[model samples]
Target: MKSSRKGLEICCGITATFLIVVALVFTTLWFTTFKPKEPEITAYPVGLEDINVFSIFFVRNITLNMTITINNHRNVGSFEFKNATAYVNYRGGVVAEVPIGQNLVPARGKLNTTTSADLMVGKIITNPVFFDDVAAGSLNLTATAALHGKVRLFEFVKIRATALSTCDISFSIASRNVQSTCKSKIKL
Candidate 1:
């Protein structure tokens, strides 16, 4: 009777071991066939084209103007520029950094915007003013555009999110010193 009991115990142990092995194999197969994939990310650089100082005038005690235009050539997702900030310098001297415009850029397309600021310009002479010392000037513009949404993933899926893109550039200001000078002296 004792030997019979021992044989039954061994059989039970072997059956339990076989069941555990089968369970492990099934779990492995399930995980390998049903796990989610990681997200795919792609980013492109921004470029500038036809950047110009659109207009310059004194608007309510400030020398205000609209400046900057950009061309985005991104092949994926949506690109939007909500606002932009840039700076201008006169002969390497920091002059101003003004906020441009609160504009929107369509998804996967191009856009143009403006940056406006108020400045203090005091002229020394108004009537036939003959000034001699007029130096050179430079402008360094930087812009930030907020990007949202995502492009078609693998020709089927769509991944969406919000991100930001920034651009910095420097260029020479042409004919900046020879502009019309009034009789007021600049107090800067």
Candidate 2:
């Protein structure tokens, strides 16, 4: 009876190992066969194409206007973005970082959203040189947005994509004319 029990334990161990190996192989094949597309993201200052609010500085208050456009390029499932944040930079100095809650962008369609950052002119304009530059007008701004999201395949398989976008904006306070260009990338 002791020998029989030892044999039964060995058999169970071997069976478990075989099942684990099979499961690993199946998972490998599944990932190699299935591919999920990354979502497309674009960001820019709102209404820059025509006439729009780029940045307004009045007294000690400053308001920056921007928009982020997200497109779920895949046909399968909706892309959900969490912990989205936007940063505005002036000459490599980060002025503000705005928190944009969670968003679920529909597949094949697009989500056009707007976010604004209110900054204090006194705090950001610390040095006299920077203040002089702003007083002269023609401020160049660089804005960046990062989002963490995931796309699911076959209901259970989830693919994570980190979307990043950078925008270069040129706004003339004196001229009231603004122009910007942005490029987006996704890391899977």
Candidate whose TM-score is highest: 2
Clashes of 1: 10
Q: CA shift at 8, candidate 2, in angstroms?
A: 28
* Per-residue accuracy of model 2 over 11-114 as CA lDDT, tens digit each: 99999999999999878865664444545666556543343223333346556666677776553656677977788787667877766778877656788887
Ten residues in a row with the worst lDDT in model 1? 179-188
Q: Model 1, residue 150: what's the lDDT?
A: 41
Q: Which portions of model 1 miss their true places by more than 4 Å?
A: 1-64, 81-84, 120-188
Give the Cα lDDT of each candidate. Answer: 0.39, 0.68
Clashing residue pairs for model 2: none
lDDT of 1 by residue, 115-175 (tens): 4544322221111221222122444333343434343423454445344434443434463
Q: What stretches of model 2 exceed 4 Å from their correct place?
A: 1-40, 46-58, 74-77, 127-137
Over all chains combined, what TM-score does candidate 2 have? 0.63
Model 2 weakest lDDT span, ten residues long:
48-57
